[model samples]
Each structure stands twice: as structure tokens, then as C-alpha cells.
Target: MTPLGPLLLLGFISGHLTLTRSAKILTVVLVGGSHYLLFDEISHILHESGHNVSMLVQLGNPRIKGVNYTGRNNSYRVISWSANEEYISSFNSWFLEQQKSFFEGSESLSTFLKFMGHLALQCELILGDTSLMDSLTAEQFDIVLIDAFNPCSFLVAEKLRARFLAVHVSNFWSWYLAGLPSPISYVPAARSMLSDRMGFWERLKNSAMFLGSWLTERMLYSQFDHTIRKCFPPGSQPVLSELYLKAELSIYNTDFTLDFPRPLLPNVVYVGGLLSKPARPLPQDLEDIILTAGDEGFIVVTFGSMLASVNLPVVLEQINAAFSQLPQLVIWRHLHTHWPSGVLPAQNVKLVDWLPQNDLLGHPKTRLLVTHGGLNSLMEAVYHGVPVIGIPLFGDQFDNMVRAEAKGFGLTVQVNQLQALGNAMATVIEDKRYKASALTLSHIHRSHPFPPRQRLVQWVDHIVQHGGRHLRPFGLDQPWYQQYLLDIILFSLAIVSLAVYIVTHLLKFAVGYLCSGGKLKVA
Candidate 1:
């Protein structure tokens, strides 16, 4: 061949190799709300990075209505299994009832266990669908990224027989599942709502919470096990806990700048603020409102997506009353239709059906954020250097608020204490310390060598290109007793006990001989 012909052939070969290097990634989205958003973000990132990405969306929650389950606008394909309308209505009703119980302070262990049962039912529905399973198996995905909030994702990964990575939306569950060391002496438990700096009683409470959480997790696993056995062949059924350890990596949606310092394995990566971006110009209407507020600025109030659906008239009145006391404009995320019949929003408060949360937080005129303490919102607040007043509702929200408060960037008021909402907002807004700490945290979070999205994409690419087996710790494969070194401690204790028994006998015999003037005493 001529020189030019050889050069053209070489370029063609290089392009082919680059295309072949792209991995086929299947993201399992079982639930919705923030969990779906996180997985969607990951799918898009991987797809943008030249990977073949597909999303497997199994609708489990009715609350996730109107979401684009399919990657319609994206280049990747989407395979979705939507639940029946009746089932969706039932699930939505049950979920709202649970929320009501939580607001009324009547939520019990039984209610939580019942919720776990609901999750199991949803998993069972997906697994029972033969066509869906066949379609997923045919894809032959290279790896799976699972939302670790629901145990069902583990079973899905197992059914696909693919190496998987877990995306933990909160700070704590993945640590417990992956056998990562979490010292209850300082590290707070999942929903304990306690900070790392604990006195004696607080530490005891943390320890108790950890044990309770472990037990609850086991119970949840057992519920999933029934589905596993029912769906899979006898020998092929995989243990949920084992699948958790089998994850190549666990990406936590948290950062140390916002979360308390804790032990992490090499395979664990913190990719908080994946959805955060630089502020874009707000719509003219919102801009005009901000301008009208002058130097007093504005406050953003949102109780997250799901909580916005909940109707707490008393709580709403209290919030409106509190916002009325402020000089700043309050842009609250609440449906105009859902507004209470008689109650009216304060003159300073602007009620909208939806608001651009990240954009609002990033705005120069934004002063404080009144949130329900979702991790995503908190991370955005930290990213934008905005102080918060958390009105934590449930789940990890309480713990997240605790961390925010411990970091000195915010404070929390319980839902029952809506009366304190105004005062808490005033404190965070007036005190320069909170804002300074938030700015410092933002600096630390942004000062990383690479951004969180970059870290997520790079680490995921690294794991997919090269298996993460070497990155996993040996302890992940060990039994619980071995992981804690309980077996070694027990063996050492046994040896020490035997030696003491012999030594004590020898000493007694010597004393008896001396006392008896060299004559042996008969028993």
C-alpha cells in the first residue's frame, strides 16, 4: 500500500478500538423521587462519557408520577416496567398514610415493617414479570449501577448476573452493607439525629440506634429473601447481603465537608453535589422579585418533592406565620391548588407550584434556605455557601440536619416546633458565623482536585475499564465474627483462661504442701 493508504488504515483501527472500549452500563431505577434523580444523573454522565447506557426503570412508587422514566431525550435506550394503575393508587395512598402518621408522631415499628413489606411486594411484581426479565437478560450489560436504598436492586443485579456498583443516596446504609467500619463511639447512626460530637448518653443512644438499624435491615433483607427464593432456582438464589459486598464500588452522595468524618474503604467514593452547577440567570419574574427585595435578599422554602404533596394545614399555617415575620422575600415551593382554604401566604412570601432549587440557592441575592433537610438540598446549600434552617421530616433528613448543625453552618427545628421556625431563620440570616462557615465549607467542597461529577465519572470509568476486585478489602468477604476479629479475641481469651486455671492449681498445691510440713493432705 502507499504511505497515505497505511495512515488511513491506522486511523480507522484507532477509531474502532475507542468505540469498543465503551462499556454497556445498565442503571436499575426501582423507586423514584430523589433516588430516581440520582440514578438519572449517573446514567446521563456515563452516556456523555461515551458509554452505552440503558436505564431499567421498574415503577414501585406511585408518588413518582409524571417523571420521564425513559431516557427519551438522551441517546441511550430505556426499558421500563410500569405498575398497574390500581397498584399505583394503592401504593400512593399507603405512602401518604405513613406520612400522616409520621407527622402525627404516631409512626411505629409496625408501620415501618409494613412499609418494608410494600417494598417487597413491588420487587415481587417486577421479578414475576417474565418478559421484562428476558428483555434485561438479553441486553448482556457489562455492569449495573443500582440504587441501594431498596434491597430489591440487589436482587435485580443478581438476576442479571452482572457486576454492579451501588449508589448510596444517604451517608450510612452503604457503610453497614459493605462491612465498612463505622465506629458508633463517634459516628452517628442513620436516623439517630445525633451528631459526631456526643456525650455519654448520646453515644449510648447512637449505639442503640445502630443496633436497631442493623436488626431492621436484616428484617428487610428477610422480606426480600422470600422474593429471591420464589423468583430464582434453588441453587441460583443469591443472598442479599452477599450481593451488597459483591458491589465493585459504593458511591455515597455525601461529602465530608457536609457529613461527619467516618471510615471509608478504598472502593467507596464520595460524589456529593453531582447535580450542582454554577448559577444560571433566573427567569425575569423571579429576578424582578429578587430585585424588589433589595439588600434584605430572599429565602427559599421547600420541603422536597414528596413532602410538597403532603397537606399539613397546621404546619402550613405555622410556616406562613413564621415567613410573615421576616423582612426578606420568601419563595416557597407549594402547589397553588394545595394551599389551605382559608389561610393566606404572607405579603413577603411568594408561593409557586415549582421553583428551580439549585438555581435559587446559587443566586447572589439568596440569604437562607428553609428546607426539610434532604441530603441533595443540603449538599447544594453547602455548594452555594448558603446557610439552612432544616425542618427535617423523616428518613435521613433528621441526621442530615444534625450534621449541618454540627458543622456550624445551620440549625434544625422539629416539625412540631414550627413556632421556632422564624427565630431559627433569623439566627442563621443575622449571624455572620453561619454564613462564614458555609462559605468555608463551600470552599473546601469545591477545592477538591476535581469536581464531584468528574470524580463520579472517572471512578466509574476506572472501575468499568478495570475490575474493582483489587480495590475491595479482604474484610468484605469475611464472616461477621471474622470481620470484627471476634473469633481471634475469643481464642485468645480461651488460651488465657486455660493458663490461669493451671497456674492457680499449681499455686494452691504448693501452699498446701508448705502448710502441711511436707505431708500430703487427702481429700
Candidate 2:
């Protein structure tokens, strides 16, 4: 062949390889709101990378109804299974009650357990739909990425016979699932509300919290056993805990700069700020408000999407009163229709049904953030160098706020202490140190050798291209007893006990012989 012919052949072979390299990826989205949005961002990233991505969406939460879970202009395929209206209503009722209980400080362990039961029932609904499962299986996906909150996703991945990775919407729980070492000495347990710097009593409490979390997870997983058996053949049912360990990768939506230092395995990746990007221009109305604020700038207040429908009249009154005391314009994310009957927002406070949170946070005129301490919000605040006043409600919110406070960029007040909200906001805004610390963190988060999105995409590509088995530690396959070296400890204890017994008897014989004047005594 001529030189030009060889070049043409090489180009054709390269194109063929590129076409063959694209993998078919399936993302399981079980919950709605921010959880759904996180998965959507992941699917979009993969789709942009030339992978054929499909999303399996289960509309389990009625609160997220009518919103486009997927972006308006997207190329990825979506397969959705929405629950019946009756189920949706029941879920919505339970969710509102749960929110009320949390705000009232009346939520208990039993309530959380009931929520787990709801998850199991949702899983049953998903698996019982034979046509949906058949359609998913027909796709023959190369890999599955699941939201780690629901154990049912593990079962779904099992049913599809695909290797899977877990995407934890927060920084904590997935550590346990990945079997990552979490020494209670420094790494605080999930939702324990303790920071890495723990005193003696705090350490004890942290350890207890770890035990409680482990028990809670076991109880949570046990609720799904019946569903597993009902859905799978007798011998083929997947063990929920085992499925957790089988994950090829555990991707946490947290960054080390924002999270406390902790040990992580090779398969664990932190992609905290994947959703963060450069700020876009705000709408004209919002821009006008920003311009009117002048030297004071504005404060952004949002309690996250889950709490959008929940109205706490007492808390609302306190917050409204607090916002009235501030000089800065308060851009609060609360439905005007759901505003408490008698509580009136101050003239400086702007109440809107919806606001572009990221854009507002990134705006130069934005001074402070009043948040529910969700990880996503915290990450965005850190990304934009904005200080925060966290009013943590539930789940990992408390812990996320603790991390922010520990990092010196924020302070937290309980829901009951809503009166302190204004003071905390004032402190964060007036204290130059808080702003300096936040800017430092933002720089560190942005200055990492690789950005979060790139890390997520590269690690995922690596796992899909070469498989993640080699990256997994051998200890994950070992039994719990072996993992803790319990057998070795037992053997060592036995040997010591036997030696002690022999030495004691010999000492007795020697003493008896000496007391008997060297005479032997017959038994």
C-alpha cells in the first residue's frame, strides 16, 4: 500500500476503536428532589462523554411531582415508573408528619424505622413490575450506578446481573457500605453531631453512635429480606450487606476540604462539587434586587427542597422576625402561599417560590447564606466562598453543619433556637475571619490537581474500562471475625491461659516440696 493508504487505514482503525469504547451505562434513581438531581448530573456527564446512558427513575416521592427531574434539553433516555396516586398521597402524608416531628424535636427511632419500612414497600412495587424489569434487563447495561440510600438498588443491580457502583448523596453512610476504615478516635460517626476533635466523653459518645448506626443499618437491611425472597429465586437472593461490599466503587458527594480528614479505600472517590459551576447571570428582577441592596449586599436563605412544603409557623415567625432585624436584603426560598397566616416578612425580605440557588450563591452581591446545612448547599457555599449560618433539621444536616463550624466558615443553631438565627448570620457576615476561612477553603477545593467532575468521570471510566476488582482491598472479602483479628486474639489468649496454668501448678509443687522438707507425698 502507498503511504497515504496506510494513514487512511490507521485513521479508520482509530475511529472503530473509539466507537467500541463507548459503554452502555444505567443509572438507578429511586428518590426525587436533590437525590434525583445528583443522579441526573451523573447521567448527563456520562452521556456527554459519549457513553449511551439511560436513567431508571422510580417516582416514589410525591413532593417532587411535576418538576422535570431531567433537564429540559437532554439527550439521555429516561425510563420512569411512577407510583399510583394512592401510594403518592400516603407517602406525602407520612413525609409531612415526619417533617413536623423533626421541627418539633419529637422524631424518634421508631419513626425512622417506619420510614425504612416505606422504602422496602417501594422496592417491592418496583420489583413487582415484571415488564419494567424485563425492559431494564433487555438493555444489557455494562455497569449500574445507584443511589446508595435505598438498598433495593443493590437488588436491582443484582437482578440485572451487572457490576455496580454507589453514589452517596452525602459524605457519611457510604463509608460503612464501602467497608472503609473509620476509627472512632477521630472520624466521628454519621449524624453523631461530633466533630473530629473529640474529648474523652465526646469520643465515648461517638463510639456509641457508631454502634447505634451499625445496628440501625442492620435493622434497615433486615426489612428488605422478605422483599428479596419474594422477588428472587430461593438460592439466588442477594444479601444486602454483601451487595454493599460488592460495589465496584463508592462515590461520595463530599470533598476533603469541606469534610474532616478520614481514611478511604482505593475504590472510594470524593466528587463533592460536581454540581458546582461558574455563576450565570441572574434574572432581571433578581438583578434589580441585587443592585438596590447597594453596599449591604444580600443574604440567601433556603431550607432545601425537602422542607419547601413543610410550614413551621413558630419557626417561620422567628425567622421572619430575625430577617426583619438585618440591614441586608434577604432572598428567602419559601412559597408565598405557604407563608404563615400572621407572620409577615420584613420589607427587605424577598419571598419567592423558587430561586436559582447556585446563581445567587455565586453572585458577587451575595454576602451570606442561611441554609438547612445540606451537603449540596454547603459544597456550593464553599465553592463560591460564601459564609453560612446552618439551621440543621435532620439526616446529615447536623453533621454537615458541624463540619462547617469546625472549619471556621459557619455556625449552627437548633430549630428551637430560631431566635439566634439573626445573631449567627450577623456574626458570619461581619467577621472577616469567616470570610477569609471560606475563601481559603474555596481556593483549596478549586485548586485540587483534578476537579471533582473530572475525578468522577475518570474514575468511572477506569472502572468500566479495566474493571474495579483490582482496586478492591482483600479485607472486604474476609469475614467480620477475621477482619477484626478475633481468631488470632482468641488463640493468643488460649496460649497465655495454658502457660499460666502450667506455671501455677509447678509453683505449687515446688512450694509443697519445700514445706515437706524435700519429701515426696503420695496421692
| Per-residue lDDT of candidate 2, residues 248-310 (tens digit) | 999999999899999899989889998788899998988998898999999999888777666
Using all chains and alpha carbons, the TM-scores for the candidates as numbered come to 0.93, 0.95
lDDT of candidate 2 at residue 222, scale 0 to 100:
89
The best candidate in terms of lDDT:
2
lDDT of 1 at 6: 86
Stretches off by above 4 angstroms in model 1 are: 1-20, 60-72, 521-523
